[model samples]
Target: MVFGFLTSRRRAGLRAQPVPPEWRQIAERNLAIFRRLSPADQEELLQHVQVFVAEKHFEGCGGLELTDEIRITIAAQACLLLLHRETDYYPRLRSILVYPSGYTAHGEHHVEGGIWEEAAEDRLGHTGQRLRALVLAWDSAKHGALDPTDGENLVLHEFAHQLDFEDASTNGTPVLESHAEYLAWGRVMNEEFEALRSAEDAGEPTLIDQYGTENPAEFFAVVTEAFFERPHALRRRHPALYERLASFYRQDPMRFVPIEQERERL
Candidate 1:
């Protein structure tokens, strides 16, 4: 219904139809994330991922080919969030603009001498700029995706921004159903946000990313990264925070991740 948003018809059209075994093979090969999902969840997600990839247009930003692997990897991660919600949850988002690797944004800044440097600003795509819902393949976007501990998974991080924007402000609160829930959400999230900010300000390392201390919105996005990538740790460190996120997401990834881990061990 909103401009720049895709219609349900368009989304229906993009639904992953019967794909050849090759595409599934490609998706499994590049998407460690796909393997993390349960079988039923995987099939459901695959359907959504198909439609998601079909509906959004992809352009090669850095001379890289928009291969099936790239599309699947991006779709797989994005669809991971939707595993617990409906496609309409992302109805506000239409296109997914991805980069081969990390990109930079240039801006102006002020100096102490009251002089402004025209090129004083240097920011990684993940670290700066909040526009143009970006899904970057960090490996290709910047230095490649091999480093799991770079404190940056651009795809996961920025898509979390898209989720944050659903509440209309990137201030960490997303669109919840009712006013009472909204009140509870504000109280819980603000408390958690304060804890993260205080921990970082005190120069103590916290399980959550320190960058989350940057602001409420950053707190939402960064904590979301912790949610998907490290659900158990989030639950262990902040049980209330984990519970609220599980409620909002409608999926107890803390439960799902462990089930997934157990399956793998077996």
Candidate 2:
């Protein structure tokens, strides 16, 4: 009875919520950045952006202040990913915490050498802490969104994690619609994951970011960044994985490939 009531209330809330004119304009403006997306995808993304901006609290972290420009800008990129799916694609994320700049936290051990080191605070991996949802360094997020090829958009990377964690643990595996799809997804992802690992091991320049080799979850996040920002390269070099992502993301990024050189390679 409780679950039913909550469900009904949730449905009512969704129904009561209306899209605003300003949100529509924001979506339309951001859509130009992703020219490869189809008209359908654009429309769908616009809706998701509208819903997300309305629902989530965009708070600035650290001492930095939040602004409407920052909130809407971040929402635009995060909502771009949902163009192919509905708002339910990111049910886990309830807030987007922003920081004026990157902040450091305490680390486990001070590795003065490979072995025999006392525990001391280190600066590495300090960004992994998630005291709040969707943490972003203001400058980092803004620059990353501005420069698509820079490979460090905090908005895209963090929001990608939220999407990956939609139905299960943040284990780099997302919930599929069917068992058969799951089986195929595992096989393909594992194979490509190993390929990425191998490339990183040999110090070979990988088209995908090396941070992807950190783990499966990071792999999913980093690959997602590539999927949206450098679709042509990802599809050309790793067509199978790209196809699976297209299926998962419900968007055919290949349709929007603007780089002639990248298309030629594919």
Candidate 3:
């Protein structure tokens, strides 16, 4: 109890601190979505960013140097998930490891019965329930930040995994507020998951990424990317899925201008 109280106090203090000019500048320059947020949401995000930056450790891997720019940029995106919601700041996540670009991850894969093969795969980001860490490629992270409408975001994808991990399982469903909410989430998510899988099997174009068909967990993460980055398209194609995400996230991203339209204005 004492520890929890102290941690909350510390975070409250961090959130209350004034936003450093450099931090503000870094967020504005690197996070395009930050520019589109309402004033209230922007302030909420900055506060979350402050607490997240103070709590999470960031390390640059593969000979890259870590900077405030990188830290703030990543934190801004991760905290974007926390906006307008009660949050523990991705309670299970502790460290963020960033590489200069896509890095090779080596692991063992099951090739057949009782046999495993070692393999290396290039990845932009990764997170798992046991790891308590997020791995990201800085270049991809920057690109995702710069192009928030792209429907793919490294930080958001991995952090969605982090949220999935919060319930002690990496299932498509996070911790919903009630049993009724859980029922709704399961029904909608299962239907959408099956739809995506069927679409993939039939070779039809899909708005929710074919990768979501990998499993329920990846479906959650992929839809989260679509929820934030391609809200209108997701809503148009899958209203129930979009409504579930908006209810869970407590943010209706359709309020923001489409990036294409914003570019046309420029």
Clashes of each: 12, 2, 0
In candidate 2, what are the lDDT values of residues 28-108, reduced to their tens digit?
453345444566665555555555666787776677788655776677788777664544636666677777776664335
- Top model by lDDT, which number? 3
Per-residue lDDT tens digits for candidate 1, residues 138-223, read 35432212222333455667666777776567677877767887888888889988887788778887878888877887888877
Candidate 1: 10-residue stretch with minimal lDDT: 141-150
- Expressed as tens digits, the lDDT of each residue in 140-188 for candidate 3 is 9999999878788888999999988888988888878889899999999
Ten contiguous residues minimizing lDDT sum, candidate 2: 122-131
Q: How much RMSD separates candidate 3 from the native structure?
A: 2.9
After superposition, candidate 3 runs with Cα above 4 Å error: 1-3, 112-114, 259-266
Cα-based lDDT at residue 88, candidate 3: 87
* Collision count of model 3: 0
Better of 2 and 3 by lDDT: 3
User: Which residues of candidate 1, in runs, are more than 4 Å off?
Assistant: 1-6, 89-95, 109-117, 120-152, 256-266
Reference-based TM-score of each model: 0.80, 0.78, 0.95
